[model samples]
Target: MQALGFEVLWKGKNFARLMGGLWVALRISLIAVGISLVAGVLMGALMTRKNPVVKALTRLYLETVRIMPQMVLLFLAFFGTTRWFGWNLSGETASVIVFALWGTAEMGDLVRGALESIPRHQYESAAALGLDGKQSFLYVILPQTLRRLLPQVINLVTRMIKTTSLVLMIGVVEMLKVAQQIIEANRMKVPNAAFGVYLTVLVLYFLACWPVSLLAKALEKRWS
Candidate 1:
């Protein structure tokens, strides 16, 4: 235990770097989640429309995003897009863009699922009350759909947070990256630093995710 690099993390400089990296992860996830929620809701609503062409296009977009691995997406954003398109993007900016794209696709599917799960009777009742399409959706549909959507959104957020570790692959220096750096720096002296550093990172991820999980459960109980 003492042979591990736990002491490195306790050092002020490393701890500060760890916290800074964690904040980077948090910032990326929060912004991505926000952008994705709005885009997803609009796209998901469009997906349910009567136009076959629009539906097909939307489905294709969703499937393409779903099928691609996130690491591949990040690489494409960081390397392919920048080189091929002549777009200059910083590592953090690229990470946010890729994650936002991924989150939007996922959230759109969740929105579509929630909207579809709402019984037809609810819509019928709204129509019977002389409610127009927009009114019906705003008053009768959105509130109920929100109950289901919130938990799923929270789950997506946790996933995005966890996957932020992948940003390290592109040299983003996020939490896991900082941990790896510390381990590498101390590997010879501590001998067992790799295991301790990773264990600490795992604990940090758990700490980050647990609250969102608890929030989802609480929302479920409250809304159910």
Candidate 2:
């Protein structure tokens, strides 16, 4: 009986605020993903090296990230750091830092696996073509590695976007926070507003993420 259009009309301004919060979430996710990509590529390259010390360090970092829950990491970064070190970190900043760390660890592992999966003969072929270390990587190795990495990296991006919702716990006031606020304000008048608002949020997230998922699938199919 409750039409979607009616709900929209009733809470139009709140809907606009939700969009603004979504923009905040998108911005944070983008910055975190960018940092993660660069740091991850470097860490992945290091992980592939034969140096034991380098391998150990990278392994430790990867494991630590993998073992910890993201919420716990967020808390540590936002609350624990401020308490222990007297560092004034904003919720948004802490969320970015935590996500960047997590994404970097995952991406590093993906890159390492992709690089190591390259056949031994590929390296031999590159060297036989008179390619030096840098040339081999740039001209021969990296292109293929990128192909393998593209799909997985795109998937990681979607994950980061979804995970940014957790930032609300630390008072980042992203889309979920906006939704909560709207629900509270309209609880008395629009009894079913929670369903409509949350459904809208779900649709927004799906709209944002579904394209990336499709792109990943397309790339995977093409590369496969």
Candidate 3:
């Protein structure tokens, strides 16, 4: 048992290589999350507007992203575009783009819900207090909407982080892909390496996600 641990953990810097792959995953997820937050908030805000054209456009985006699978989107971005448009996108770039699109749709919906959930009286109260549309949204409406959105947004962050594993399908060489490589390389000698390697990957993902989950719960409790 101890020998198996040594083989998996210490053999040829396998752990270090895995950590590198994890870094790749983390970097992609973070970039995607940042883009999604900015774009999603704007999309969501537009979705709540009374303008028919804006609502229709945002709705189409939301539904398209909601209906498409992330894997398919990744393939389309990475492989299809190269064939059709001559734009050769890297796997990491494709993964980030796909995730940002998915996250935007999700975050936009959450934001829309949060914004709409604000009571009509709040708007009336803001108007009574001499607050114009901009002032009411900035000072009165946005804060409450953000408070409502916080937990769900954090949850989406965790989801995006986990979903980054799918980038492996497109040859992104993230943690899971690294794990598979390690297992294949050691299949001859360290027969039990798969268990250890995959278990380590699992623990890594759990560690990354658990704190986000806790933060979400804490925000929910504090805001409730």
Candidate No. with top TM-score: 1
lDDT of 2: 0.88
Compared with the true structure, all predictions reach lDDT values of 0.87, 0.88, 0.89
All candidates in order of lDDT, best leading:
3, 2, 1
Put down candidate 2 lDDT per residue, 134-191, tens digits, no spaces: 8998787877987989978988999899988999989899998998888888777777
Q: Looking at model 1, report the run of 10 residues with the lowest lDDT sum.
A: 3-12
Error of 2 at 132 (Å): 1.5
- lDDT leader: 3
Candidate 3 displacement at residue 98 in angstroms:
1.0
RMSD for each of the candidates: 1.5, 2.0, 1.8
In model 3, the clashing pairs are none
Q: Give lDDT tens digits, candidate 3, residues 1-224.
A: 64454366677788899999999999999999999998887778899989999889899989988898888899999999999999989999888889998988899999899999999999999999999999998999988998988878988999899999999999899999999999888887888888888888999999888888888788778878
Q: State residue 31's C-alpha deviation in candidate 1, in Å.
A: 0.9
Q: How does model 1 score by TM-score?
A: 0.94
lDDT-best of 2 and 3: 3
lDDT by residue (49-81, candidate 1, tens digit) is: 889999999899899988999999999999998
Write down the lDDT that model 3 would get: 0.89
Q: Model 1: C-alpha RMSD to truth?
A: 1.5
